[model samples]
Target: MIPSLKNILIVCLLLAALPACKPKTAGPLPPQIDYGQDTCDACGMVIDQPRFAAATLLVNGEYLKFDDVGEMLAYHMNHPEAQVAAWFVHDYLSEEWILGETTKFVKSPTIQTPMAGGIVAFADQAQAEAFAAERNGKLFTLDEMRAQVHMVEHP
Candidate 1:
């Protein structure tokens, strides 16, 4: 009915080792974004748009959510040391989450995005082309986002 000293010590050691039990570098963690209540991990602005949301899984197994993909980019640009495990963005057309690096992007002043970045993502080049054609926008690859991100105003 009573616990022994040896049992207590064992339990304490197990509790302390629990942190070490987490998987390391086996795979990237999934990104989590809370629609309205979540603040942009980069600029501390509330993420209100379901259309322009972005999030990334850091190498440390932490998630950084953003109101705009531009905010996410600005953070990475400013903090070049950030270890990003995976990048994700919401498709402006579908509001669906997709891998950021593989997705096509368009920058248009006609499209009003959070942070005034005016950048949008699409899962396919055709989609990006169609969107850009209708809006007179320019298309870019993920690697090119770093350059367009300069258009976003930093907080």
Candidate 2:
């Protein structure tokens, strides 16, 4: 028995739709920030600030862009749906992306963020200390920062 003409067309349509239904693997993240344009994955805000921008690279190479380091931390703390392979944040002074795990974060009311997160990233601990000295901010590791964000959300 031969397949009907309508059945063949339906099969072709189904085949074409399969790829669209599958989760696509994204390419590497952009090397630099596109301030005032990139949308935050956590809060849906525009990432217009360089110093406060943050992102997490998923294991599949997809990125979850954020407007603030604290927002990123809060998202990671609250969301258990996805695991991040790596994380990046902008340095307050340089406005360049740095490894979030290796960077030090300073959180103070004086260090204002886009979302009022009051978090800043620094490449050097001394620089963080200096920033803290300048504003009485407390320096924290990424883990510590995550915990602090968790506390705020959970408590």
Candidate 3:
């Protein structure tokens, strides 16, 4: 038996409505790699590098982009205590990578910033004084008693 015009119209409407029955979420496919191997230089740990992990730190409008783990570690190591963070970007050139930072070779162990208070211990008072003078800071030496003992009460 032939279907009525009304029934045919209903069937056509159902077919059209079928597409809207299920919702579709659209996005680019997930990145194909495990980013856990990425490391941090300052804090000395691994970084979680993901697309949603975007962060920006600017200085005087001259900005440095450190979305990847390698860049962040480099920034942190040089800055030492600078409030910088990083993640990992896949380097197609050299393949294998770890947490690292770009650093200039310096003969002395000077703190990168004035705000950074680094500990430099010496065996004698004179040597400590000399080092402090060279570095432009107050210096102290480990006394014979304090040298042997690990902890002491500060006056």
Best model per TM-score: 1
The segments of candidate 3 whose C-alpha lies over 4 angstroms from its true place after superposition are: 38-155
Pairs with steric clashes in candidate 3: 68-87, 68-88, 69-87, 69-88, 74-101
Provide TM-scores for the models: 0.76, 0.75, 0.26
Off by over 4 Å in 2: 1-32, 151-155
* Model 3 per-residue lDDT tens digits across residues 89-143: 2221233321112111111236231112233233234554565577665532222
After best superposition, candidate 2 residue 117: deviation in angstroms? 0.8
Alpha carbon deviation, residue 121, candidate 1 (Å): 0.3
Instruction: Choose 2 or 3, whichever is better by lDDT.
Output: 2
Give the per-residue lDDT digits (tens) of candidate 2, residues 1-155: 99999999999999999989988765345345577887888777788878788998888767888888888888887876668888898889998888888899999998778888899999988998999999988999988888888523422
TM-score ranking of the models: 1, 2, 3
List ranges where model 1 is wrong by over 4 Å.
1-29, 151-155
Clashing pairs in 1: none
Worst lDDT run of 10 residues, candidate 1, spans: 26-35
Among all windows of 10 consecutive residues in model 2, the one with the lowest summed lDDT is 24-33
Q: What do the candidate models score in CA lDDT, each in turn?
A: 0.83, 0.84, 0.35
Q: What is the alpha-carbon lDDT for the whole of candidate 1?
A: 0.83
